[model samples]
Target: MELTADQDDELRALTTSSEVSAAVGTRARIVLWHAEGRMKKDIAVLAGVSRPTVDLWLGRYAADGAAGLFATKPGGPREQVSADVRSHVLALTRVTPPAETGLSHWSTRTMADYVTRTTGTPISHHWVANLWREHGLKPQKQGTFKLSKDPAFADKVADIVGLYLDPPGSAVVLSLDEKTQIQALDRTQPLLPIEFDRSEQRTHDYVRHGTTNLFAALNVGTGEVVGDCVPSRNGPAFLAFLKKAVAPHAGREIHVVLDNLSTHTTPDVKAWLAANPNVHFHFTPTGSSWLNQIETWFGIITRQAIRRGTFASVQVLVRTIRAYITSWNTDPRPFQWTATADEILAKVRLTQLNIKKLVANNTK
Candidate 1:
């Protein structure tokens, strides 16, 4: 079917509305009904619209086939902040605190004021926002994390990573790390289904089910995870976890890369170390905890498996974690480290040389 100029305009006008809107869907359904040769009342009943509305749409469609459902009102090209002016504003943003603009972090209103002050152009707040976005700029806060410092840390890291990188025959390569004192919280309400006229579900307050220290080791070759929940996450606990991760396999060297916590280098750990020539530990470069493979898996668990979770108790949380591990292990896939041996070695040398330079400076 085809439409007249008036019908084309009517259909084209719908471009302003979203595709999922009832107005658009209604037009589609009506056109489909007309194509099927259904009467106006029957189409109205099926589409949940009034008979008159159906007739109006059908009349429009009869006059103008597919083109009638849309309107072609033109919009003018958007006025934008000039390239020079935007760059100037961005430079100002870096030098001047947002307080001078009467707002924080270069908001649209603030940017508008800044542009006006510098160029005397009465830029609208909305235009200011679009211009900032156009120039690839937005307000964002910086994140923070703890740093590590351990002498001889990098030299031994390779030997630790070797278990995963190139393990001894018939040996399991486990990447071990501890996530400490994880709080088990339960939401008060079940998640509400998304629907019309339904009450939103919410948690009035959270129930603390107690905290558990997660001592986890990832078998990179096998892609299986061995995890334990303990009451504490101290150095002693770490040694115990090492014992558990290493105990199952005999006569094979288990290379593990981890952070240098005080507990990890304790006397008990030293004694354990003496006993197990089969187990080796590697430490990541200071401020580079992100290099640990076990930490990568931990990120997956936090985002995909544990974020916004509600457990009934510590036991329930443990059970859920176990179930998740079981499900994951069913399709155990090995993870390959992409960073080259040379990159690792270079950073190690740089860190060691920097330390030596510091020591020489102190002596002088």
Candidate 2:
């Protein structure tokens, strides 16, 4: 069986190419051997197959070149799950289960059970799971979402995002927040220092040396942080930190973005804001402390300074926190906001719509 030049080159390329499937590569070799005048028995021995397999491929190549090799029929039944059943399962996954179903989210077993019960089709959980994989559906997992119910959500988001993206000329934008109840914990046993092949380890139990609140203000332009450990997260502590935080940028207009904490809206805080007209307060929407950039700074301090520290006393904890803040300000990089107020509002509205649908379905 002599092959055309194009067919010969194609078979050779398929045999050599790394991406060619094992079955296709073996067939190509068999065809090449037949073209080279090797007997079917010899080709089968060289290709690690029975003589009939070599004869089959040689006949296919003689008849249709490379195209004949891929023309084999599928070996199994064409249908397992019917089209209607697949559509029904997909529909069930896309919506919340009714209250009578007693489920907040659908699992593979539960979905299979529900489908079998509703449609009289006995489908296995594994099959349901495989269907989900094929369709990119994950009914078992749920992502957290919060849509602000605050009436001033739009205005607050605008105010904070505006200060981040385009601050007033020559004004300082500061993100302020408090990390409360940071326990000064000492490990029950001394930590095992990291070795050549082992990681550093610490005991699960610890001695509590009391807790402190860390009040911080991050300058958006310079990324410098002004902060101190306080005894409480109350009106007094916040006011004291406010005085220190605003002192550096005294002559310039200072816009502070903070969460809607009770201490931030107290009578004393309001009076202080009134007295200091140059210092303005912009509150983030309720339950949305993630909007405040200072929280990122707090996360850094927690991971680097406090999370793994062995502080025997509250004073040591306070000192360690102060030292970290001072070290951070040496080479601070500011946090920049990428999402606009409009984008945020659009997402919140979409989430709210989805949640409303879920609630309605739950009620039904």
Which candidate number has the best TM-score? 2
Specify the poorest-scoring 10-residue window by lDDT in model 1.
195-204
Residues 41-160, candidate 2, lDDT per residue (tens digit)? 877776789998888888866544454565445565543887767877766676556558876566565688888886677886667766776776654333124456689989998888
C-alpha RMSD (angstroms) for model 1: 15.3
The deviation in Å at residue 360 for candidate 1 is: 26
Q: Per-prediction TM-score, please?
A: 0.52, 0.60
**TM-score for candidate 1:** 0.52
The residue ranges of model 1 lying beyond 4 angstroms of the native Cα positions read 1-172, 190-204, 341-364
Colliding residue pairs in candidate 2? none
Give the per-residue lDDT of model 1 (tens digit) for 1-364.
3322233333333423343354654575566545445677877766678888887777755543433443324686676666655555555433323344444244444556666865665676556545544555443211112223555545555555555566678766677788886778886532221221223222124889898878888887877887888888787788878888877777776777677778789999988888878777776666656667788777667645564468878887777777877787899766887665567667556545544553454355
lDDT for each candidate structure: 0.61, 0.75
Candidate 1 Cα deviation (angstroms), residue 10: 42
Q: Using lDDT, give the best candidate's number.
A: 2
